[model samples]
Target: MNLVQLKMLDAIVRTQSLSKAANALHKSQPALTLAIKKLEAELGFELLDRNQYRLSLTEKGKLFHREAAQLLSAQSYLTQLANELALGNEANFKICYEQLCHAPQYNDIICDAFRQYQSTEFSVSSGKRFASLEQVNTAQADLGIGPWFDLFHATGDLESMPIGKLDIGIVCANNLVPKRVKYKQLQDYPCLAMFESEMSFDSERLSYSKGSAIMKIDDIATLKSFLISGAGWAMISLAHCQSELDSGLLQRVEVLDREHTFSAQIRVFRQYSVHHGPVARAIWQGFKRASEQFIND
Candidate 1:
């Protein structure tokens, strides 16, 4: 009859035993029995058959349980709407970034802003270029930070803010490899590619050279590992592999500029469904300021 009594019945049906339902709900067996009996008395019908060792819902009980579940769902939705209006996301603030985006700026924007909103949990993750964009579009992410490729600029119902720019560099590993290899010659070797964990959209095309053998990995760190092992080659931002390049563990492929390498526009974005919360807004501003200050360098 009442929501509380309905919830008690729902639990009883789920666990299939009054004692088990009491234990699950952390209420005394006497209290749960009285609540259910109280509802049955008001309805002029029995909701459960007491003869069975395990709780079994009567035909009337099954109908009431369906309605009870809908009520609970509505309550949850109302609570979420209230939280959104107040701009307090009790759930985790999730933002996905592509590896090519500047890390320092991301750190300052995310870590620093999250500290200010200590009550909320923060989740940081990386994905392939297009996946980051899709996360924002689908509202799985509060924001997506990554290089600005043509796919991003062309996306509808999404808003973007430029953070910085990075040159796409073709890199290979080890001292044994020559200073420069012809673009076409790379076709014989395995080419490392960054594949998105979620396959929503893809616009990745042949750049510099086409590889005959492609090995796709979803993570950048893993791709770097393959590159360092001399397993294959990949196009990554020079900044990400700078330390390895300096240590002689990796080298730029040194292909001619005419081969169509790209300079990427690093940026951040959010969807058009709703405005970002205060925490997300602060991080966006911080990212812009960091870009102007060259914090990425």
Candidate 2:
């Protein structure tokens, strides 16, 4: 049978119900049934037992299932290999930045280039402040933008470029808390802590022992929502949360330690590959210009 028929068989087997598989695949139950019946007829053997109520694969079905999965996995691997070969270092330029504040500016530059040259595609993801660098090392990401720290100093594997620095502050629902606060005073209230990837965390500095009552989260977008909902106060870049603060939707909690700034740097990195494709070179040039403007602004 074809890949579609095999996929349907596998989905039905894993889900244990034709109706559930049909719903998940966004196909009518009747269409799914016909596909299964067709597969069975072509094989000259029963693939499923309808009387059991639970979808159970027959002996032939089990044999085909294993083979089908192997085939699909091989196909997926081949596609990824082709994509990597074609795109090279420009396959994915990952950036770790404040979703609300930094993303807009980054998107503007990248999208503008896309509109003009239309030469590459981008996929963006978010992580805790520390994880961005790790993503670069793992080849899961090609670039990163986040708080500057000593991680790069130790590894001697990355190049950190300073972008525009933004002041970090506590954000809360308007009128929900005092306009200003002391660092120690923060222990009295719940704090929304955004955790970075495991590889990014510096066990010495990021542990809960520091002082605030923390509710940790890994997703950047979700963390913003919690602050907006007034569930808790969180540390965020002032540039990112300015609109909310100005609109009275969220209140800025000024902390006593004004000098305790988190310096943000956009670090562009790649493996020491001898060959960087045209797309990679073009994107890297764009990023360099973006960083220059980012720091200047």
Candidate 3:
């Protein structure tokens, strides 16, 4: 009938004794009994099996309690959110990251932030190319993590900190190309590229031979599939395809172009000269600390 009555039923179910539930809730046993009786009258069904030795829900009571539990959880969360907001925490924090930032330590950092800021809703999304930076710059995300290409540095409206480095190599399925091949020879095969039309920066450099037939694909998983099927060769992060490379499903081509093997500094960035709340500040600091640990390791 009401939260108080629903809570009483929940306590009774948990404690399995009306007296114990009354003691736990700091209410008189008679009042607890009366509340449940009223709730049953309103619901037109008994919520408990009074004849049970300890106490238990009736068949219908179990269904009702299941739904009531969700309401209680929402109430608790709302209370916590109110308290957190009173302390000046942000209501939401969004992070957009590239696949290269999916390292264990980075994931741990995000988890730690969540634990520390339970009331702050967290949104995380993975993007390709310059999408992360674009999200941060456009105020769509509170933070961004990805490769620190020259364009990212050139973005005057963003502030960035180097977190680590990503090793990328030009690779193809073993059957698609020779172990050692010239850059020009790669032109004959299609190049799988991850391109987002809204934010393509330095994308051309991702392919070793620009003359190669370009196959623009935004999804990394699909692109990897194409490479594995000898559909095309691509410049892929060593981290993303390490297992494949190890198992010989994919092979890194030895291209004459020394730059075929590329290394880019991974960075975490946010909009420049913008104020952030406690949750955002805590996450940012956590990231910086993680970056330091990463470098030392």
Candidate 4:
């Protein structure tokens, strides 16, 4: 009828006596007898044979006991799993990173975290521009690695630590633009910009030039494709296009404007919440250590 009743039945069948079962279970003999009686009455079948000298299970009792044992085992495992979760063992950990933050050190850190928490499922995804920040802020991801912008500082809900700096400059296909191109001259060619819902064409920052033929791209890979095809010039992270630059597939365009080249702090961030689990915390600490080593180097 219930776990208590099923347990009493189990103890009675095991000990072969109600008195002994009561003593083993720390319940009164009368209480054990009543529990069995109630269970038999509820099931419309006797679980114990009264005619036997030593108590033995009825034929139906054997089948019920077998199934009840499985339930007890499942209940035990469930209880243990709940306790583990309560202690901050995450079952699934998700991480979102921007394309610029795709470095070997970061991959190593994530692999280390996965090895440390082998039972936890780890998911890694690449996002464009501020996509990582949006994912972490909206609770779509547990952790995020991306370039830190001043706007992120204004969002008090996020806790971030700078991991390193990424150099971003205007780049285009070889021979696509003049070596010493003026800022205004860039408007003659199409300009590629990372697509953000709130992005404005009026801003001169980050490759957005006013009066230029603007091409909005959703991801870094596609933007690189366009750049390689000489579709346009864009502000891109040097780290992301290193191989291309090395092979002369892409070339950095020198701009007369001083702000053409700048360093952005790459950071790991998470939403401020008490619900962050042990695995997430470990990964965050790993990033912090990596950041320290990067700074020292």
Model 1 TM-score?
0.65
Candidate 1: count the clashes: 0
The C-alpha local distance difference test score for the whole of candidate 2 amounts to 0.66
Clashes in model 4: which pairs? none
List, residue by residue over 1-297, the lDDT tens digit for candidate 4. 788888888778767888989997999999899889998999999888889899998899889988986676567557646856775588788899887667888889899989999988898876556778767865568888988887775653788888888898899999999867788898798989876632222133644577889888878889999999999899889888999999999999887875688788889998764355678878988988987887887
- TM-scores of the models, in the given order? 0.65, 0.59, 0.66, 0.66
- Report the lDDT tens digits of candidate 2 across residue range 1-297: 888888788779767899989986799999999998998899899988777879898887788888987786566557656776775534444444434335555566556555654445666676665665666654566665656655565542565556555567667888666777666665577778776454534553654225656778877668878888887787777776778888999987766754333545444454342234555456567777877887678
Q: Model 1: clashing residue pairs?
A: none
Clash counts for all predictions: 0, 1, 0, 0
Worst 10 residues of 2 by lDDT: 267-276
- Candidates 2 and 4 compared by TM-score, better number: 4
**Per-residue error (Å), model 2, residue 98:** 6.0
Backbone steric clashes in candidate 2, count: 1
lDDT of 4 at 49: 84
Can you rank all candidates by lDDT, best first?
3, 4, 1, 2
Q: Which stretches of candidate 4 lie over 4 Å from their true place?
A: 1-88, 197-207
lDDT of model 3, residue 114: 92
For candidate 4, the 10 contiguous residues with the lowest summed lDDT are 197-206
